[model samples]
Target: MRIKDLFLLLLLFSSLLVNAQQKEIDSLENYYHYSQDAKRMEICLELSALYRNIDPSKGLEFAKEGITLARHFKDLKTEAAILNEMGVLYRKLGELDKAMLYHKDALVIFKSTNDIMGQAYCFSNIASVNIDMGYYEMALEYANRSLELKKKLGDENQIAYSLRIIASIYHESGRYSEALPYYNQAMDYYERLNNKTEKANVMLNKAIASSSLHDDFTPEIVDSLFSQAQIIYERVGSKYGVAAVHFHRADWEVRVENYTAAEQYYLKVLEITKEIDAKVLYLKALEKISEFYEIIGRNQTAYDYLSEYVRLQKELFSESKAKEVASIESRILLREQEQEIDVLEAQQKTRNVIIVMIFVLLIAIVLFLLFFNQRYKEIKRLNNKLNDEVTHRRKSEEKLKESEEQLKVLIEDKNRFLSIISHDLRSPFSGMYGLIYLMEEQYDELSDEKIKEIIDRLSKSSSQINELLEDLLSWANLSSGNIVFKPEIFNATKLINEVVDINTYRLQTKDISCRYDSSTQFIRADYFMVKTVFMNLLTNAIKFSDSNSQIEIEREIIDDRIVFSIIDHGIGMNEDALKKIQQPGKHVSKSGTMGEKGSGVGLLLVYDLLKKHGSQPEFSSSPGEGTTVKFSLPVK
Candidate 1:
């Protein structure tokens, strides 16, 4: 094709891309107006991400709306997700500090909710912002953390993205050799995933790094890589990506001493950045073009470009500083609101106490009047039937004594239940609080290993607290007869696999393997209840099982019932423990082989759920032998 024809085609393609994106945005906006509650919030979040690269200001507007809706709906996960997206938008707009603040806030929410994948993405985003701010060490640290989490999640695409970020950090710090291997790894992953956009991105980065290693990659090889990346970027309609390719191409040309070609590439970069309204890229182009002019001895032209670059830089810095100040003011406002809420709560409590006192005083006065009237009646009756009144009083005293004894029993039971709950819940929370306090007071003084250790402990405590709350809620619902048993036919095998999958981290931690037959088996039971039962049992087995041990899950058909068994090789129960387990109301749990603690309500929940299914859990164990727990459900 002729050069003019190619240029016309590129312009046409860019127009079509913009039109398509605008149509999508219009459709979403229409739907958003009609949508209500959670769906509207979801659309808002989607729109925010959609507009991020194209129009950051619009993206921030949608993100803020999403955050408001998420908070209103008490959806912490979605709120954190929108906060992270806002951070990305801010980063794109060159507000690095504000971006970091948003990401850190999102990270805190993700951690509190135990959203591992959300936390991983936030780390990656924070790393990107740090890179832009020239904090390479901090960037590398967060990037590695993100990479570790992505690997744990087993998400190939996310892992590749993390790898790419880490590579960029190295490349920015001038460690070209270290960056190359990571870029290659990321490229390989993207190639396998068939993600053309990311693959092209990595190709561009690899080319830049390879340009520094002329001994390994020839100039021709580097040029080919850049050509490949440009083609892909154009095909994908990535305007910013295309601009990046042009900017880097200019750098490669300058490196090869091709001043004329380099100047053309730099001008092309300037045109693309302006067309896309990418301020960051535009600033970079202006700086580079000024340098290029100086290199060619065009002092007057260089001064003009240099002056423009300085002005633009100052404007961006001023905008970023303004955003930082706004963020600080917003935080101060939030703090003030919280303090006002605390004061209101205190006033409300005082009013409640005063109201209660007034109610008690009124009751006391009424009782006094009733007592005076009763005494007057008693005085009149005493003359007529003193013996009859004495006999009635004796019987009444005996009945009152009996009622008091019953009330005492009820109070003791209530106290015992409350004690059990408070002890289990408070222990974990106190440990978590102590760790947090230590970190808050001495974070700067702590070594990395010590911080990691504290984090691990905090995670465990949080997990323990979460488990306790879940079990408590389940037990409360079961005891109150609020949990309805809705039976349905479902694949029992699939349920077992899901339960196992959720406990993967635990299984990996203990180095325990689970063995179950892959067979299609349907059973009639409450799907959620049965899932809960399986989860609790499997978790118990994992906790008890020694490292490198295997837990076997088996299902066999016996008559009309499907018998499911979980057998674990670990410390078995003694006679006392067995007796305790047999008691339906008793919460029977012990420290596991690895000294893992539990709220002891899990087994009670399991037993209650099994009973609702018209089945009982049978246990077989010896003091030194491993335990086997089996239950049956109706096969449909």
Candidate 2:
């Protein structure tokens, strides 16, 4: 095609792109004005991100509006999300301090809400800004932390992004070889997800890393990679990618002493950077061009480009400082407006006083009687209002105190539960770790039978660990009100049989037998919670029972309530222990006949659940006399 024809086509494409973007903005604006409540807040956030690159000032304005609306609605999640968008916008505008401030603010919210993914993203953003400021150590710390979190979340795209960030950190620190592995890992993940834009981005960086590796890189291979990345970027219309590729190519040409080719590539980089409004890339391209000219002995040309680069750098710095000043001025204006309101109020009070004084003498005698009556009425009304306010405040304080006390109790229970879990967890984990270490060290000298024995021990430890974790999570969910309580009609016998089957190993280990008479009754209660209660009761019975003992589970309909009991023939507790078990927080547990561990956490959980069901456990036990625990639920 002719040059003029190509130019016309490009112009048409640019016009169409501009028109499309404007239409999107207009549609969103209409929706924003017409929307209400959270919808309007959401539109504001959307518009904020849409305008972030095209018009940063407008983006910041929309972001501020979003934050205000979210705060008014007490929507912390929306507020945190908007804060992150504002941070990114500020970063794009080159306000690094403001960017970091917003990110840290969002981080506080994310941490408070326990949003792991949100926290990870915040850390990654902080690291990006730190990298820009040349704080490599801080950047590395945040990036690594983000990578670890993303890994745990098992989000491949996020993990890839994190890996890419870490690679860039290494690359910036001149550890090209160290960066290569991470870049490759990120590329592989992106490829597997079929993320064209991100995959291309990783490819470009990987190429750059290879180029920087000097003797380890083959020029042909690096060039091929760069070509592939550039094609993908161009296909995707990524201006940043295009600019980056051009700059890298210019650098490579300069390194190989191809002055003419380097000049052409540098000029292309500058043009693309200017088109994209990327000040940093444009300045870098100018600096690189100047260096190339100086090396080629064109001193005058080099000086002119050098001066332009310095001028642009200073202009960018001045713009950032001006923005900071503008922000401070805005805050000052808000304070001034508040002060103006105070002055207006004072003037109104003065006017009222003057009017009262002028009218005081007109009806002196009549006014005296009228004033007394009005004053009395006013005092009566004020007294009543004051009393109501005092009562309301007292009530509010009482509720607050009650909530605080309840929260404290829950926290203490959680701590105790966690302590038991940690101890239980530590035993299995430490055993597995030690056993694995032993096998590894003695692999060559150990017999096959010994290795098998070690494997068996590892499996047992793993099973114990898994069971403990499951119980811990279930209890935590139950206590935190996260578990949904849905009552339904279900056969009690089936649930009991399932619970018994689950504990078959323990039953067999103790050479114990369980007997239960199946009932055809349906109960109206939370099936899961009821099942958990049964499981805990049976577990406790088995733990306390001796080898070859019998555990009897029975269900009886008494006065329209289904009563369930688990009777165990084993060593029983004394009066004090029984009393302690019935009381809250005083869970007195002892080792079983087989030296099995007992935390009593399970019993406490059962007690709370039973109370929730409008009943309590009836425990009867004495030394060597055995124990019987029973609870009741409403029948359907």
Candidate 3:
């Protein structure tokens, strides 16, 4: 059949599946109105699970309702189940951190309840979230834990699921050879259970892995596997599975140099993914087709497809979508507050009834008037205590509001930091692309000198990108608190000289001379951190210095501390610019004297490393003269 006809059939099949799910949801909602307490919570959980793939927002609404009911009924198991389902929904929505939080919360409850099965499920969910967040090692660890738990429980189906997760983690981490055996084991289990959809998924993944193995699996064998998976997917009416098969088939074709077949397969993937509204898959298809076009020298077509892919990606992760997610969370919180208010109102009504009954009894017993007066006084005192508690709660709420505001500021800073990194990274790639395109399209028309200059520019751009990436990674590690400060006695002079030697090429390029006294100076500090600080400072000095300029590296003993300084006859910053650079969370980048690029992450990293060692770098600079940076470390 033609690919278009095949996609049409797939679309029709997907519509049927969607309709079936919708009908089931409607029936559950109808039954929910007639149910009470636990049954209602069960319905909510079911609906949430059903809506997870179709509409995560709707799933979240149902999950919230389920959580409220489960808590009211004191059903910890059900609450944990709902929480896990909510995590899955959030993962689908691309809120990975939120998903991880929900999964961890579910795991805690499962542990408290001693529910091994629930705990296994939570581990698997957490593994899935870690996989989404690109933490493959953590994902593998959790997946193995889940598999062990499933094995202990002797549940073959759950064990198979865990095996699949483990295999996927390996696959995503580019350990396809290791992933193959796990996929085989999972596929065997699904085959034994006669689970056609899952069996097809495993077949597809196995085929992809095999294709990536080059000579290990023949092209014919890979083709046979794809055919088998497609047959099963069509029989099960799984359009997603079929689309995935087509996407990988395209990749296999490209690997085998069958460009025409790859193009057709890619088009089929796009059509099927778009028809089924599988946006992530659709985006992948768009990106692959763009690359495919570029490889075939169809530059305009490639550019068009790339533009579309970028637009779609931005749309997927837009600020407006982030705000929508925030709105959903806010609404959930509001609902919880409303539920609390309802409970309080019910308690207040019961108390009022009790007080009225007591008053009536007191009216009948005039003999105990003194005792009644004393009781009334006690009740008034209790009321006053309740008021005091209310005031305290209000104050706590105010503090919580302040904390939330601070969190918002932090989030904004994080976003801005990411934006700056993105721009800096993109600038070099953009220049490289233009240079490459010029080389490709007009190589014959250009002179040897021009070609050499273009190559040099490409090299420089690549170097800048590399430097930015290194700085970015270091900053990320520092910000995440992954870098440990392991202080040990080390020769400060030697470390400084080592850093200076590392930048020897840059210094020679600028024709700048660096002078340092060769004196042994021992200091207690993190060796790697100190080295990084020295590297950044010296590199910055080299970048900003004029040709034939002098840089002095000085060390002085002051009591129990050793002060280190790097001074350069460079283009110095003004007061305003220096202030901005010194401030925390401020990313400042400017061109050097020779038009060299920077990511502005170097100094931030320097500041953080020094801060960890109980010191801070002080800078002195004016626009015309030079700059000096000094910091201290313990001599003991």
Kindly list the per-residue Cα lDDT of model 3 for residues 287-393, writing each as its tens digit.
78888887888878877776677567656645534655454444344344444566476833322322332333333334234433553453344233334335434
lDDT score of residue 530 within candidate 1? 97
TM-score of structure candidate 1: 0.40
Q: Write the candidate numbers in order of decreasing TM-score.
A: 3, 2, 1
Task: List the candidates' TM-scores in order.
Answer: 0.40, 0.43, 0.45
- In model 1, state the lDDT of residue 344: 78
lDDT (0-100) at residue 487 of candidate 2?
Answer: 83
Q: Each model's C-alpha lDDT? A: 0.79, 0.77, 0.80
RMSD of every prediction? 31.6, 29.2, 32.4
Q: How does candidate 3 fare on TM-score?
A: 0.45
Error of 1 at 224 (Å): 4.0
Clashing pairs counted in every model = 0, 0, 0
- Ranked candidates (lDDT, high to low): 3, 1, 2
For model 2 the TM-score comes to 0.43
lDDT of 1 by residue, 1-636 (tens): 122222232333344366678889999999998999899999999998888756776677778789989999999999999999999988976678889999999999999999999999999999988887889999999999999999999999999989978887787677888998899999899989989987987897788788877567688888898899999999988877788778888977887789999999999988988897777678878877887887888968877776677567657755754664444333333334444456476833322322333343344345434644573463333233334435544654574566457545444434544665678877887888899999999999999999999999998888887898798767655653457889999999898889999999999989999999978899999999999999999999898888889999988899999999999988888887877787765766578888899877888788889999998788887775788999999999
| Model 3, position 126: C-alpha lDDT score | 92
Candidate 3 colliding pairs, count: 0
